[model samples]
Target: MTLFTGLAAVAHAQGMSVSSSAFADNALLPAIHAGAGDCGGTNTSPPLEWKNLPQATRSVVIKMTDPDGAKGGGVVHWIAYNIPASVLSLPAGAGDKSGDQITVGKNVSGAAAYRGACPPVGDTPHHYVITVTATDLDPGRLPPGLDAAGLAVALAGHTLNGSTIVARYGR
Candidate 1:
């Protein structure tokens, strides 16, 4: 067993696991070099690739979030679901409605989109954690516009496995 300190300490204690290809713990955001702002910093979603999913997975769900947000402890930046099991990657800006093999849900902006990193000024860099959950249910069951809570209810007793990647964004 391992332990994480600070803001992420709670999540670690709760048994949420995380990993990434472009970034890691205490790692900087590569999108910054590509000209994207931290959360709310730009409008483009970062490109991501993942693998090593659990064998029981029938569908995959992806979500982008900034745990450090305005007055709510954390905020949802993007929610995407119904990803086919064959998909293993998402290009930058793929969180938009145009992305293939997936559907985007309503964001904090209430526009069913992926809002980029835009942390408060002068604050420590915020962590944008992108997670992929593998589920045993059919992807077609999930309708668009499901909030996190709704998605959770829909996924009850269905999650088989999951993976995650984290990036830090700050000015």
Candidate 2:
């Protein structure tokens, strides 16, 4: 089986909690892939589709972070802000563009792009949680490089709702 497929198997066996319509629950991207490094075979953003959002949702915020990252504070792999609520899906490679309506934020590597999971070889699998939040305001106002804490501060009272999808991978 391909690496992606292998990763999916692990997620399934591990009981990851994510929306069934999102990539973590889909069969296509069995694993999460990011840009850069030997572990980064592809720069795709993993297609994402969601529903059951509230009516006040003007935009959505998508973020992928490795809570079990090698470092202590965890790692941010991907962040896309100001996604119009009308948009139901983010096609693979959506993060390829810079400063688009779908803003890309800084990852763990300090770059404004996705850095896929590439744990030290032979290490245990790591869990990556991909979360989507429906906001009452536009995500465009938020600037890039705002880590989780920064994001939480900016989203103080504007968050209408949210959801999550989790996937696992390791090398």
Candidate 3:
């Protein structure tokens, strides 16, 4: 099986799945969800939904990364964690600076908000991988303002199950 299929199987076995209303898996991201700068879009975060989390889950973490960004060194567009397990979805714009309920972590740009997809002009469309992880940690276990790397370090050994969706965007 493909690596993605293998991972999906694992997640399915753990009873979790994630999806977005703004785009299908492996589909092009809408311009409304692109960055507002040179990318020329509205910079709105897409709506996301997840379900069937593991019974032991106490919190959730969401991360979006552009594997092709920054000279092939991956860039984190968003990191949100410490979300109550009872929350099954995030509405559009929920990644904004003023978002509530969930703790917003810093993105690659150091902003505790979503930085929508913005690939370099003329490059092939870049893939944005968004993952939602269910963890056993309490909703308030993690502090705010942690960046992607820091979040990763904090999440070690805590993830119980997770799911991922891939969207493409380009200038």
Candidate 4:
């Protein structure tokens, strides 16, 4: 198996799972999580669930990125951090600012909110890698409004382990 496949197998064996109620693993994300505008979606955050996090975990950071966005690396769709370890799941539309359980960090769109897929029309479906990282960073200590790149830099030594669930979306 390839390294990714092997790692996925290992993660599965470890019982660390990140899942979504709106769709199955590797399935297409629902329209609620789709990007607004020409894509025509409500742009709500999909509900997410996780289990068997590492013992050292103190917080969590949930993010989503489109791997086939025709960009060099990928296009970040969401970056939400400061999630308490006690919280194992997020309800649909939880990314909204009001009554949100965690801090929704800045995304590629410069909005600190979930902005779903808006891939170019006629392009192949893009794989959106939704990752849930368990980390040791204290929410209070983290600077406010950190973007994906900034949070990634801060999570270097703090990350314990993570789970990834892939979903697809296209225009």
Clashing pairs in 3: none
Model 4: per-residue Cα lDDT over 61-132, one tens digit each: 888888787564788888888888899999988975424448887878788788878888877778989999
Model 3: residues with Cα > 4 Å off, grouped in runs: 1-13
What are the per-residue Cα lDDT tens digits for candidate 3 across 18-126? 9999899999999888999788777788899999898789999999999999989999998888889999999998866634568888988898888889999999999
Shift of residue 165 alpha carbon in model 3, Å = 0.2
Top-lDDT candidate index: 3
Q: Which lDDT tens digits does candidate 2 get at residues 1-171?
A: 599998876554343222643343423334446444566446567767777666677888888887877655687888777778787777666764455568777676667776666655675666777888888877567876776667778789998667787777666
**Clashing pairs in model 1, backbone N/Cα/C closer than 3 A:** 38-117, 38-118, 39-117, 39-118, 40-116, 40-117, 40-118, 41-117, 41-118
Alpha-carbon deviation at 36 in model 2, angstroms:
3.7
Candidate 4: 10-residue stretch with minimal lDDT: 95-104
Tell me the spans in candidate 2 whose CA falls farther than 4 Å from its real position: 1-35
Clashes of each: 9, 1, 0, 0
Candidate 4 regions with alpha-carbon error over 4 angstroms = 1-13, 98-100
Clashing pairs in 2: 45-93
What's the lDDT for candidate 3? 0.89
Off by over 4 Å in 1: 1-25, 31-41, 98-100
Which candidate do you rate higher for lDDT, 1 or 2?
A: 1
- What TM-score would each prediction reach against the true structure? 0.77, 0.77, 0.90, 0.87
Residue range 1-171, candidate 1, lDDT tens digits:
354455365553344344545566558776532224433345766667766666566778888878887754898878888887777777766766634578788877677777777777787888877888888877666888887778889889998777677788776
TM-score, ranked from best to worst: 3, 4, 1, 2
